[model samples]
Target: MQPPADLLLPDLDRTGAVPMLRQVYLALRAAILAGALPPGARLPSTRALGRQLGLARNTVVAAYDQLLAEGFVTGRVGAGTQVSRDLPEGLDAAAPPPPPAAPPAPAPDAAHRFRPDAAAHQPSALPFNTGRTSWDDRSQAVWRGLTLRRLARPDPALFGYGDPQGARPLREAIATHLRAARAVRCDPDQVVVTAGAQQAIDLVLRVLLEPGDAVWVEDPCYPALRAALAAARVRIVPVAVDGQGMDVAAGIAAAPAARLAYVTPSSQYPMGVVLSMARRLDLLAWARRAGAFLLEDDYDSEFRYAGRPLAALQGIDDAGRVIYVGTFSKVLFPGLRLGYAVLPPSLLEAVRAARLLVDWHPAGLAEGVVTDFLAEGHFAQHVRRMRLRYRAARDALVAALAEHAPALAAEPPDQGLKLLARLPAGMDDVALAAAAARRGVVARPVSPMFLAAPPVAALMLGFSGHEPAALRRAAWALGAVL
Candidate 1:
């Protein structure tokens, strides 16, 4: 019989990686599965098919043989290969049916803490996004050069499984940087290099917290913290954040017996407020009395445009109550996914076990690159240059808001990559943010950060990753959005 032009045989790639016969078999199997070739439909003889496809008769015959063996097609001496009616049905019957979709099996008591919005901080480019990090030509070239050098002279061990606590040299470098720059009280031995601050958060939750244990988290908090707390099945007690950061008094009044607490002490997230020394003392006292641990997420404390300087909570805690979390995402870039937790000596092995269970360890080659970056002092130099650029971006954004969108009150931050822009009272900040996003500005709503009713309507504007000119253009477009 004469063959048709289309075997719907996917175009044969004679020069491709896959063998010709296997490719042919796959194409014919796909056609059968897709119902393009109905049951009992006759295939042309191997010789005729070979001619149509420009393949040798042997290759076509071999392809047909595979399909026959797989039961997707049938062949007899007189009747040429034909599509099998029962193949797809039989395959489906062999596999188990899919389960119905349902909510995740978080502890029933902690279900209320798992709000959907907490997990919604996705990436957006340009004018304002908490997720992006600043980078210029100088920093990019340095990073590329360092990375290429590592790739060229790879350590054989990098290809093998890595240490769960991360590479020893990287941990030592991180400890050195934290001690000098952030006043963190830690040594290389106590440091557990994590994928990022989020994984560090998850590691702490796994190692220390038990299901249904009450935990203190800042109200209007960093969403990722809230989500992680909930996912770990801890009862998240929302402690109100005032000008002094997380209100320790409020947390005590609400959940004094809480097992653990999470705080961004150096600079409160979203609001960019520092924890006053008085409040920090009070928090440490509370943890001591309650015999609880504190997670001090030192988020975005690096770029202080003004102030005497912020100290890490972990640096001050002598009682070993603090688990200090810091990330290179803000300083380097979010894609690096490298962070470290300065754990208490007591929690070291437990955290290591939890890290092993979670993801084994952070990527090795990146760790190697960062170790050199810190050891050779490129990290400090890069941070210094990027500070000036980020400061300029912040100023430009604030200025643009003043010029075009005066109604939105912007609090240009003295620290951190983002600032809070208050919307008019009674206005919906979430709706305004959605509108701004449509106009290419990633304005995050401050109201959604709160667990309950928000006291104010505002947007969080990030400035670290933009050029001054780009920030101005985006802010003007955002004004148009307004």
Candidate 2:
């Protein structure tokens, strides 16, 4: 009798670099991950699968045998091959519970401090959220490998409470990465590792600013910065940005008395503008004269698409005014939640104390893995590969928008992974974004990034996490919603 022909098989092209068995493994793994082939789904016989994929029966048998060894499949004489029913106990779907009821109100001071309105400050949706990276399996494999190696290490340091600042090796790795990739000059001792960039921001605010002290945050800047500063009781002064970058002259004029100025100069958040050399020098000079420090967030600067990447502000700060912040969230993965702050020699002790008072330090094992990953150059290689992939995705998004959404206009950015698309006059970006989300496309409104009042209506679309084809479909879907 003949075998059933409905079983799916992976089509492997000989021209690709991946091995055939690995491709087959990935195809089956992806099917499982997507729930396309549910647990206990029947698989085809090895002989039947061989014919479908144009491979020898032994090759098919070998692939299935490996799957069985990995506990991903099972077999019986009459039952044929089937996906494992056990599924490691957590693979099956489950329904989520409903939310709890509201509680009674509290006293006046308590109510004021614990107002429900605080929830409004939290981001409802993360459409086009900045600093997101592609979370593909290839990247996961690298991290997993690093984790396993770290687990095998016999050192007691791996299990102990890490230094409140960070692991020395990880700090050294960061110093090397920054100097090579960002042109920033700093010693390993100057790097203070934290949970992530947000934590670093909080630490900087706590250590540097007192209540009522003024700080300059870029107008239409990263909203979280405003919240962080507000939570620290620092008065925020908005400084506008132009094509060159943050308006340095305006920042000096508006907040000359401010103690610190936060700028995303490498690729300004929401706008994706690179700070030009002239403006960088001007801002550095202004900070020196105003006796203010510059908090330069160079997040996602590794993915520059245009000419040579710009040097970080810290590299050029002769006055010891730049507090440089960077994160592995974009370079590695966000879930790792590792970031570092490179402070001038003067601020090191204060920032270290704040970090110690907050969370003590980030995880030791994760930091060790990252240290190995960076030391071995895997992080650099991953960044290089993703940079090319992101450039392609960005171009695809641009072309698709131009073809499908003629009414929308995107300001081309010289660097960075995201860009702003201006809606035609009369269209409401906030409403349009709501409609887009319903269609499975996550696009954010540009208005909320602004301070006090919105200056324009636009959408911020991120291309780093998606492929070229997927980005095109997302853009088309967005157009249909509009």
Which candidate leads in TM-score? 1
Cα lDDT tens digits for candidate 2, 1-482: 22335656556878859777777777777676556667778877777777788877887787788888988888889888888877854554554687797786655652332222232242322434445677566767988898887788745975667788999999999999899888899999999999988889888888888989999888787867777776676688988877787888887777787899999988787777768999999988888888889999988788888877788988988889999998888777777899999999999999998898889878998888889889998887888788888888788888889988878998557688888899998888888988887887777788767884456799988877766777777778888987
Report, for all candidates in order, the number of backbone clashes. Answer: 0, 0
User: RMSD in angstroms, candidate 2?
Assistant: 15.4
- Model 2 scores a TM of 0.74
Give the C-alpha miss distance for residue 182 in model 1, angstroms.
Answer: 0.8
Screening candidate 1 with a backbone cut-off below 3 angstroms (N, C-alpha, C), the clashing residue pairs are: none
Residue range with the least summed lDDT across 10 consecutive positions in model 2: 113-122
lDDT of 1 by residue, 84-197 (tens): 766644432334677989887767765665665632566657568776787778878878999999999999988899999999999999989888888998899999999888
lDDT of 1: 0.84
lDDT for each candidate structure: 0.84, 0.80
Model 1 regions lying over 4 Å from their true place: 1-19, 23-119, 452-454
Q: What's the TM-score of each model vs. the native?
A: 0.81, 0.74
